[model samples]
Target: MTDETQIMEINKPISKTVVAIKRIDYVDIAKGIGIVLVVMGHNDFALISPFAHKLIYSFHMPMFFFMSGMFFKPDLPFLMYARHRFNRVLKPFLFMILFIYFASISFSNVGIPQASRRLIKALYGNGHYLDWVQLWFLPHLFVVSLFAYFFFQAVYRRGLFPLRWVILSVLFIGGVLGITLFWPFEPDILGRGFTVFGLPFSLDLVFVSGFFSSWGMS
Candidate 1:
């Protein structure tokens, strides 16, 4: 072989090494800690004081979102990325909801009509409308992940990586204000007063969750 071919062969391993990603131990440790905090936040244990519970609630979710963003890869085509997320996040969400709803109708005291009504409402994916309230986070998370994907693509496309946090910060502030100040669009359902805020998968929270993810990316 010629010198150029020999040189290329010699450099192949080094190139591969440069692109290889090493496992981050600290990230795993942090994720473990975050999982514990999430469990703590969800339970009303006598061991956990009210203040501690509040503290856990305040940061645990943000921590998860941030970590998710840290690993965000926006290089994939939009449809491919969406399909991956749908399989990872949305599929499980639908499965759980369907399983629970059908189980209730088949084996529990819930009548078919009642279960059907709830199943329909569950499509809204809001916490208030859900029977398994905690599951509401999944759909919202899916939306946030997609939003982050689009957002980072825009930033990279425009060469605005440096200003990404600035843009996200502004959006975060606006989201906070909007959620706190404005009343949700409360539409009555089932002849009872049901307040639904974020329709079609908690879109209202996209900005806030996107900010946390973007922070992780930075």
Candidate 2:
């Protein structure tokens, strides 16, 4: 063998330390813009153009959902994972539900009727247990993340690396397209509305897109 071939073979087994430095200034800027849009949307400000509103709605919540998934590493034990998820997701969800209910009461005076309907649905186990308009995404995300966690665990146990990611991508994309195609084009039904298949113009599609995007980022 030549000298170069000898050297290459000798060095082939050593691991390389490759550090990746991310330039996330654009991400930060986008997040800032998203926060502004969210505030304006909530306050009924006319500053947001209709096109901007549509664009923001398309990706803002999805971006936030992907951000939420970024911190979830799978190295922890199952019990620890459960605890962490509960604290991070469930606790905040409960708090938001209560807070929004009160806010609706104070600001709109339609709280009692809305809350009553939500409570009835919760009791009957139909629709989401919580009915806060801006807060529905939280519960949806929590559930989706939990499902993803378990799915990751199962794939990890099987010693699949890149193949698992491929499977996840296919499922996520297929789900998004399927839901978007079949989604109902109507407003949610009172108290009984639930759409896991991207009803009301592909809401779950965006969330699933965010979930898949999170995995792609890592």
Candidate 3:
């Protein structure tokens, strides 16, 4: 190899870090329970007991979202988090979309024009069921985590957290009222409600799940 190649290799990022984390058994158990509930809710056998599925659906998302938020560090650098999200969420998202898209082209009547249009929409995340129903949650969770990181730093990092909780209690009531009245939109904060497959990074869910994310942060 040339000296230029050697220099480039030496400058490359090591791309690995070792950190010890204490595992909390109950948290894992709760997440596992939520996962089971999510599966059961989607299973066709669940049609036999709709109310049970409803109960599972009611709490499972919140439980899952809360668990996701619980480990967020308010102090982590944004670029670091972006890199993490790109690896964990965006990579999987792109891979799955490509896999599903190609599978469709192979098995279905998807012509070049149709497939290209589908690719555009899928990349933008502009559909309610973007290519597949299950994949939407990862991007939505990614978006909500972004909101939580900033919100936690702004509210909690400055010692305003205790008072903010009191204020948030009132706001939570208002949020519930608004949700009840206005079809799940939250007045388009920070101008991020732009549309894509369904909402870019699942923007609408950012507000709703943000509550859970912030709660977990606390």
Q: Which candidate comes out best when scored by TM-score?
A: 1
lDDT by residue (56-103, candidate 1, tens digit) is 888989998998888887889999998998898889999999999999
Best-to-worst lDDT order? 1, 3, 2
Q: Estimate each model's TM-score.
A: 0.82, 0.59, 0.75
Check candidate 3 and list the clashing pairs. Answer: 125-196, 125-197, 126-196, 126-197, 126-198, 127-197, 127-198
Per-residue error (Å), model 1, residue 74: 1.0
For model 3, residues 75-162, the per-residue Cα lDDT tens digits are 6699888678678777888898888888888999888688777777777553364767678787777777778777777788788887
Candidate with the larger lDDT of 1 and 2: 1
lDDT per residue for candidate 2 within 15-93, as digits (tens), equals: 7999998768866786787788677666644464776667767766666666656656677887787777778766786
Greater-lDDT candidate between 2 and 3: 3
Worst 10 residues of 3 by lDDT: 179-188
Count of clashing pairs, candidate 2: 0
